[model samples]
Target: MAEFLSLAEAVRRTLRDGDTVAFEGFTHLIPHAAAHETIRQGIKDLALIRMTPDIIYDQMIGMGLARKVVFSYAGNPGVGLLRRMRDAIENAYPRAIDTVEHSHSAMAQAYEAGAAGLPLAVFRGYKGADLPKVNPDIRFVTCPFTGEQLAAVPAHRPDVTVIHAQKASRKGDVLIEGIIGVQKEAALAAKRVLVTVEEVVPDFRGLHPNLCILPHWTIDAIAVVPGGAHPSYTHGYYARDNKAYLEWDGISADREAFAAWMRDNVLTVGPEIFAERVKGL
Candidate 1:
């Protein structure tokens, strides 16, 4: 039997103070609604882990929800650095634990190692570069036979993996499009997995078998939320909320405006209010 929960309940069940949460999706395709809900509920001491952190990270930091973040880059979607994130770094208020800048391919490989229960994965990208500078924890190993130096990235087992998908079954099977490396690996490596989907189908039979990215057994909870990935997109569905993001980008530049936005949209507003505000968007 599988457990079905609302997005809020799923987040409440999986997240805790001082937990390391691995979030799926890229910059514009991030799961902001759930993250926002987490912040609204006041889940403190969160450590965010991502290949590249962006506006969502900045918002979390701005709202004082994130205590630590491990990532390679933090910036706006198309614009360069995110203002609030830059402010956070410049002031050194919310601590940042930086990591090596790796291509999406390399990041997938590292998470794959964690999923496969391996100690580390050896790759060839560490020579004569600044990667080692960002991630000093990565080890440099030489093959005995080839005498070739390689970068060994250790497995990262996060406390929780929160991914927003296009569709899910009542039994917890998830359907995601495009690359499933991070989502798949995170599902396998994390102690618990919480999936928020735009729609909940009766069963897997209605969905294309090939589109089923994750099986039900891997998910601890399945949350049915229509706009779960707002500010992000669901493949074959709606596009990201670019207008909302642009608004956030503009207001986030000013401390007073950012605080007000957070208070109105995030702190005071509940899920119902958020849904109402984004009804036409």
Candidate 2:
């Protein structure tokens, strides 16, 4: 049931202002192209969700597209801080964005709970952690069988979940291999799923059957975007661009530099350029 479309069309059709969008990827296979397309299309007021929000979310926050962010970690990967996000939070530069923080375990459990159609995720966490003092969402529930207490948080059911995968069969089934993180659960938790892949093949018959595969029926749209996860790497295809990550600290340190960089790089380019950018990676 997945419709194969261009990245621009897929993003425009599935993403909108005020939507809760989760660009789920771990250290690898980050959906940079889809996020770039969303930025190019000027979608705003998004509630962004991720377990680890790296450069992509920083770019979105820098562009002033996000009104809220739900995440466990925010950084530039190996780099120091997400300067743009810090600016928005501390100084309200482009706009004041709200933040809801959680532990890595809680986020993963929340996504799993959503995929399971549960209202909340319950787990043993936050024991002696000060996170509960600040994050009111971290509450406690008593076990029925035992007198033990468990931590609970609302499940994350995003409006759209976008991810970059290594390949997709012509039938629309997606293949993601390397550090998948919560991509699967996030996709299942969302109302709509949009995927970008490095290539589209006739079928995945020769690949390992036990590999992580999302059936065609689960996705709404797919875009063949080679190098779509640029700077983040695509496992068997290329390595992560560590230089870019290092440079981001300087590029995003100032508001003007960040805006100019986005204007020149993101706003001026189309998704097609991603394929070219990955050359020699």
Candidate 3:
């Protein structure tokens, strides 16, 4: 059964040191509040997984919380590179983070395989791509019928998967709309699931059946966190904070500045402040 809990308590109970954690969102509904809570709690040595890792992952890696990163692409989204991630890989300033690279299609397949309880994701990818030459995990299997070789990679089964959503029912079923990603598969593949939502409604009775709904049984905890996905937008609640994204380039470029900004902003405030942060947007 899903339990309604505070963001702090939910993170504390679900995540542990050296856990494999995935914060899944494409461009929308990124779990920024839960990520901040994890940082504030000082969880360490995480193996973070994502298909497209944006600013939130950069923040976590810069803090030296990640020991390994499994992903297809890493960037600041519309901006340029993720400076912190580049530093970790190139300079190893914070620490040397082991990386496993993949194509977008391969990663999606891996998550689907994990959700289906499969050991490997075999798909048609990496054809003429150089990733297989570098990443030993990228192997090939012979198709029994066609004899055509298919790419194979280990499934991604995270210990805990956290995601932000637009709404949750009182019974704890989560609702996510607009630009859906592999969040559903990631949650199903995880041992534990935590969801932070804009609000909790009475019931989802009248909503369209086709809307994406994660039944209460699938989630372990629900945190009522309005604006939980700040910078990233909820479908109907708020628009994306474009100004914040533009400002982050300068803020994250310098180590001292990043540390100071995080201390003054994220460290000092709780999730409640996020409700106010998105108001002006």
Model 2: per-residue Cα lDDT over 1-281, one tens digit each:
79999889999899988999999999999999999999999999999999999989999998899999999999998878999999999989689999999999999999999999999999999999999998999999999999799999999999999999999999999999978899999999999999999999999988888899999999999999999999899999988989989989999998888889898889998887888888997
Per-model TM-score, in order, reads: 0.89, 0.99, 0.99
lDDT of model 2 at residue 49? 98
- Looking at model 3, residue 132 earns an lDDT score of 89
Task: Write down the TM-score for model 3.
Answer: 0.99
Q: Write the number of the candidate with greater TM-score, choosing between 1 and 2.
A: 2
lDDT, residue 202, candidate 3: 95
Off by over 4 Å in 1: 27-29, 94-103, 179-181, 273-281
**Over 4 Å off, model 2:** none
Separate clash counts for every candidate: 0, 0, 0
In model 3, which runs have C-alpha deviations exceeding 4 angstroms? none
Query: Least accurate stretch of 10 residues (summed lDDT) in model 2?
Result: 269-278
Better candidate number, 1 or 3, judged by TM-score: 3
Candidate 3 C-alpha lDDT tens digits along 2-66: 99999999999999999999999999999999999999999999999999999999999999999
Question: lDDT for each of the candidates?
Answer: 0.72, 0.93, 0.93
In angstroms, give how far residue 239 of model 1 lies from its true place: 1.4
